[model samples]
Target chain A: MSEKQLHEDQFYITGLKENNTSVIQAIYKKFVPKVIQHIKNNNGSEAEAQDVVQEVLITIYQQATEKKLQLTCPFDAYFFLLCKRKWLNELKKSSQKEVTFLNENVSKDESLQEMVFQTETFSEKQALFDLMFQQLGEKCKEVLRLSFVTKSMEEVAVKLGVTYAYVRKKKSLCTGQLTQLIRESVHYQSLKNK
Target chain B: MQEEMYFAFEQYLGNEMNLEDRAAFEKKLLEDTYWKESFELYQQTHQFLKTKFSGETAAFKQNLKQIALENQSNKNSSKIVPMYSKWFAVAATVVLFCSIWFFMQSNEPKYVEYNQHEKAYFTARSEGVAILKEAQDAFNTKAYESAVGYFEQIPQANRNEEINLYYAIALLEVNKFEQAETLLQAIKSGNSVYKEKAIWYLGLSKLKQKDYSSCKQLLEVLPESADDYNKAQEILEKL
Candidate 1:
């Protein structure tokens, strides 16, 4: 996040954040073919390859939005690595048989590795947080949802027909309660240990 | 005790604490590992909630899904066409040769024997942009003039080797000989998967223009690595 220079490919991230059509089309045209080939050569179908590419792009969009991701390497290298890893993981999850992968053109650049690591971690944590958040009580869910969505404590209080102080207290307690729920989960514990 | 601590957590985050209380809270956070971790998790949970409820997430996802669907349909359509036509070409060649093998062997090879160009597939590459779909449709239907018109709409920078090859073929079909040869020569000089195909098409253009000596010269140099080297040799013998 410090003085490391941003690559020229940062336009892809910004275009994703803004949901630019031409940029997305450009990404598909320029980068998706090699990934499809890699997947097809390794006992995967074109449909599976398409899903992997789409899922990776969505994860990248989420990471870019939530974490303000900056690219230090070529987008091609970063994106291909992410898709290849995701496809391999998918293969492992679906089968118990030992899978020998085709020789991949993996980049060993330190910054690219570091960037992939960060994005993967971010996706995992976000998934866990979403799961825990869904387990909160109905009342707590309502309070937190309205508080964040309306983005104003006073408005939320009026909508809920409660006092400002009550909404304020509930917002804090509900968030704290959600955090406590996450901390006590086995998934969170494993993530923290890792 | 826990409620008060959580209250203090909220107050500290909201910037509602006095200077002295804020100082105490900061010191406690530094010294107390459990409190610091809880506070950090609390902040992250808040950020997650903020983003989850934001307007952009749903809109972005919907747009992405739409784009993916369009791309999928385009891929399915474009993929099926070339594969089907290629197999059809092979089958037609087999059927025709089986019925007339003795008669055709003695006659001079006609240009029609080798004119089964694979159908153009530009939609997937163009991704529904520009005039690629129109060009593909026109080329597949043998409307070479219209195909040439649509191909000319593509900007120079957007024209890759495949696009140029297809465009040059359309030009040759419509008898725009000089322009077609110039483009085919440029493609032949460049390094790409389309290079060999470009050379083959250049030879075909010469054949169409009745320059059999030049066509013979071009076909003679078709490398063994080319997919159409056998076809080139067949044409070379007849020429």
Candidate 2:
């Protein structure tokens, strides 16, 4: 990504933290086109490209929101790698016998392939997290995601159109709820017993 | 911490406790092993919840987009109007026709007088430019609503199709659907490069209003060359 694009992504991530849809749209407008082109060049159709782009953006959104993801590499390379790997996985899962030129090109991107390997290895942890989330109440899940993943309490407040105090209180309540849920989870209980 | 203190502990975990209260809470947490253990549990739960919730959010957004796509395709293939009750449709039509009749009867004399009066003339050349400038400035500042408002203020006569396109986009940003539709209607399709965007938004406006059939119809006509054409087609299908 260019410095300008990097700055835009940073601003977008900040907005997402706050739950600002417009900022998210701006970010979408900036990167989605390039990502789509890259996907198409890699043998994916427009629909596939759209899905890949959305997933990549969502991954970025989630990481930035939860981990307070600081970009060490330019977002372009990192984002491209994630999407490329996801597409490759899809192709592999489909059991295609013949490799297309685009697939070959994607395979050639060694850095991206490495990133994918590093990230994909965490599928087990992700599955666990997904189960825990599913057990949470809808409101609790929403509040926690808003607080940790998106990072914009102000935007969340505005979206919810509730007072800042209410947003804070709700977030705390949701976190507490999740904590209770995790404690009661079968996996956690089994781990404790072990 | 007592059960009653859990709420306070929750606040503390979120860093919402006042400075003095936070300091006192931290001290208590450090001094009391039970409180310290509880806090650690809370921290772990919080971290777990964060990851879980993020994953769920990502899934939800992805699902919403998929739904949109599915709906569009369904609309194109079937053209099935989900049945509204006959009685409801009859009642709506009766109310609409009666209201239009009543409006026409009441406004007939006034319409004649208004038509006879000197046509008001105002040059929008300068004003349109100024408003366009303001809209761009507001967009740059991320003041989406303000940008929409300024864009709307540009006179339709003086505004080029490009300006109208931007105006519709601004209205979309602010979720002002009716205004966007009105502006979009005035811009001729053949000359405007943004015709596809206009059709897409028009369909979206109808979708927002739950006028699924109209949305499907408009979306069906959206040029395949448009950026969102496939997405639009998908939504139309679902509708």
Question: TM-score: which candidate is best?
Answer: 1
TM-score of each model, in listed order: 0.58, 0.37
**Model 2: TM-score for chain B:** 0.41
Candidate topping DockQ: 1
Q: What is the interface RMSD of each candidate, in Å?
A: 1.9, 7.4
Runs in model 1 lying further than 4 Å from the true structure: A1-3, A96-98, A102-106, B11-24, B82-239
- Candidate 2 Cα errors over 4 Å, as ranges: A1-9, A15-30, A37-45, A91-127, A136-194, B1-8, B14-21, B28-239
Evaluated on chain A only, model 2 obtains a TM-score of 0.51
Cα-based RMSD of candidate 1: 19.0
TM-score of chain B of 1: 0.54
Question: RMSD, each candidate, Å?
Answer: 19.0, 22.7
**lDDT score for candidate 1 against the true structure:** 0.85
User: Clash number for every model?
Assistant: 0, 22
Error in Å for residue A146 of model 2: 14
Docking class of 1: acceptable
